[model samples]
Target: MPNMGRKLRVGMVGGGGPANFFGGPHRRGILIDNSAELTAGALRSNPDDAIASARDLFFTRGYGDWRSMIAEEAKRDDGIDYVTIVTPNDAHFGPAVAAAEAGMGVLCEKPLVMNLDEARTLHQAVKTAGVPFVVAYTYTAFPMVMMARHMVADGKVGEVRKVEAWYPQGWLAGSRESTADAAGQKQASWRVDPSKSGASGCGGDIGTHAYEFVRFVAGLTATRVRARLKTFVPGRALDDDFTVLADLDNGGVATIAASQVTIGAQNDNGFRVVGTEGTLEWSITDHNNLKYYRAGEPVHVYRLGGMYNYFPSTITPFIRVPEGHPEGFHEAMANLHRCLEWQIRAKLGEQVPDHMHLPGIADGVAGMAFLDAAVRSGRQDGEWVDVEPVG
Candidate 1:
């Protein structure tokens, strides 16, 4: 790869408040390897708060909103090379489309937009602008996840038959917005609102992660879905629980489930891939290890960064440290940022390895399609619905 020598400049949108859950992770992820620098941002929806927050964070420049940020940045000689959007679901489409239209790279959080139509429109904007775009499917960036993906591709698990992916959290076991005393809950406030969270809350929030996880590891496209989405929390507007049975393009079946109401579960994102020859099991709680099972062989655990010569070459770049050192969420996020940096460099005439991978507009569209199908299926009383294809 060609060395630009200087770090890629980044601008951020949303994730401004001190209590913002994902803002810090994104900032850390982009700067973790010194590959990118946070130079600008429109950090909050409130005009005054946005500027103050940006200044407090030592951003080179700040704007009250994303529009001014993009407009002014486009004119600067040392403008941001890309923008990372950590906004809520409803805020994603506008900035993403605007950034792409301005010919700047975009890295946006998933459940891409409010609806499939918005997703397709955003996709068109990206395609027309010819900018490098990435969706923050954070889990797939994990080295072990990449290893699992490669294992399936190499036929370590032959002809995938069945897949199961689930993401459960206990935070919404009770109403976070309903009670009179819950006013200080900033994160859950907008999340349970239909206008802000869109069609399905839990499904849009973490369920997209589970659905994408299945697609990434099993290398299967969800073709159809039969889904049930329900809101168990009293007076909540959006569904807090989601379950789906999906038909894969290869004729295999998958069960994808996610819930915020599952008591005692905390970020318990996991999956099982069953194939003709073997099975692969993995969970975020024990992120560094992957469990393998076959008919006649004993259960095996593949640890990340293990000095295993059998590990595929594709995953080598993702491993940041020696074996047993323990890399986790932040590291996984960094891996993604690294790939996105490489992609941006590649676009600017740098040579990049063919094996270097990053999920882009297509992945975003597919995720939206999954959410759309699931929502439609839910509305129709669990009737099967086909997932929209991504071109």
Candidate 2:
């Protein structure tokens, strides 16, 4: 893309309040490339708190709510070029649709929205507006993850046969909602509340990550799913653990599972894709490396920076650091923001490369479809159910 010669202005919805753990990361990620500036925010639902939070973060302007921010920002010549949505699951649809309709690019956090219907609607809104849109499927932006996608597409793993992806987080293993202090309560409360977090909490929250990982890396699509959702915490309104068995489109099968109730597991997200020729494995725990296995050969471990020469030409430019330097969550996030920045510039008539490996509306809709299928199957006692054709 052509250099715009100036930083793009950014707005935000949610990501405010003292207890929000996600907001700061989004902010830090957006600024990491120095390609964008945080200009405005509807930081909180409360008017005064919103303004106070924005001021604290040094945002140029703030509004009482997302609607107002979108409305007012649309009228300004120096308005935000895009909006980053860090809101809860339930709040995603409205601001995302409104921002797109107002011609602002959207970078939204996942599970996209509460349901597949909302996901499609938001998808249409962005399509109609022709604004750059990105769903924050953060892991897909990791350098190793991108390399895996390249390898799979290059037929390095041959035809995928079995995919196993799992994410286990221990934060909600016990009753943190009732027993922990204020910050813990604030984080755990909404996630366990159906009205706020939507159906199948753990499934929608982290399970989608595993599902998306399989899709992005293995290039496989799940045609149907048999799932079991469990709420281990006695009074939790949503599932804290879930397992899904899916039939892949290529006559392969997949096992995707997630648990917030897994003791000693802290973001232990991993995936293994077995193909006709070999197996490719990755884990967020070792975010920078990937392991390739063959029956008669020793395992080949590829580190992020060291694999630059081995990565496809299309992806080598996205590798940000030197060899042996570690890149983690923040770098992955910044990669997403960098893609968004390039996309935003492209929307301004700059010529960008034809392919940018960032997740967009379709990926968002796919996530919702997976969640819907999983929930339906779980309700039917793990009976097989077709994934909705919505995206």
Candidate 3:
């Protein structure tokens, strides 16, 4: 079949209205390049909302059942070539496993699944199916983030020693307000529900991002974790605040925190990696700049721009606009999308870029392992627990 000169067809799952969770970002990211088509979707759990969401995004006929969407799309002559899972944390496993089993490319939201067991199953399925798979660790997609990764790899931060990383939000500061109510928008309602979001709330939701950032920038693999998890809200089933101390594979140390109950800490996410020679820091608070400090040298600021002319050549294509123009969340997602686009093409026997930087199945499995270890450590009153090795 001649599939040249055509955008890859996509089916999206669970990016519905009144809920701007991963679904929205995933859709926007996939469509940002105009190199992919959103031809089908199972946009919501409610049939009416699903229809409305699909029509709003101009996706053809939304289906309430994600499995139905996948099955029907598979049988079509011009069915979706791949599927993106943008549902809640607990909802990712089924769609992703089904997609892989059906031999379709799959892109999934992070904390890959609810637990380590699911992570292992999904990882195995995707590997055995020989399908392209990715876990959406969107922060690493940022240009400066990639630059930081490049710098660490090139020995800019000499011999990683210690790392501090966190993602904290005050939206859930109070015991009374829901995320949707607090944000006045489509926020994660199921985040505080254990059944929906799994054991650890804030950690699974955003702590993985922090841990992933540390790994991405510091070039360290976590080997073990000692953690304390807390639930501040009166009736919440999951931990909304967590602090973890981790040992990295390279003999480095990390202090990680992710909390939704922190007062006045809206989306304060970032990391600082300290090595034998220096330290590097970046955060969403200063979304466009990265802080670099070497022991004897003055602190330096790096921005998202072409004119700055200090970054590596690999950083160029990720720059979306001029110097003064800032690139933030959407661009990061789009960057991953662009990489995945070429990745999908590579599977189709077309030559594209080499060594894609997007987080893959192993990363996802590792993330889940980190979560499992943290929870275990917390249960034992901050006892150090080894992160399970995955092959």
**Over 4 Å off in model 2, which ranges?**
351-355
What digit string (tens of lDDT, one per residue) describes model 3 on residues 267-347?
Answer: 898889888777889888788888899877899888888777787766776777889898888988888777766777888
- Candidate 1 C-alpha error for residue 105, in Å: 0.8
Ranking by TM-score: 2, 1, 3
Best by TM-score: 2
lDDT of 1 at 207: 94
**Model 1 lDDT, full chain set:** 0.88
Candidate 1 lDDT tens digits, 193-308: 88988888999999999988777888898999999999898788899999999999999999999999999999999899999999999999999999989999999999987476
Clashing pairs in 2: none
lDDT of 3 at 9: 89
Better of 1 and 2 by TM-score: 2
On residues 1-391, what C-alpha lDDT tens digit does candidate 2 reach at each position?
A: 3456689899999999888888999999998877789999999979899989999999999788888899999999998999999988999999999999999999999989998888888888888899888889898988888888888888888999999999999999989989658988988888888888888799988999999988888888889999999998898889999899999989999999999999999999989989999999999989889999989999999988844578766676567777888888988888788888888887787765545468888988988998999999999999999998765
Report clashes for each candidate as comma-separated counts.
0, 0, 0
CA lDDT of every candidate: 0.88, 0.88, 0.82
The 10 consecutive residues of candidate 2 with the worst lDDT sum are: 348-357
Q: What is the C-alpha RMSD of each candidate to the true structure, in Å?
A: 1.6, 1.4, 2.7
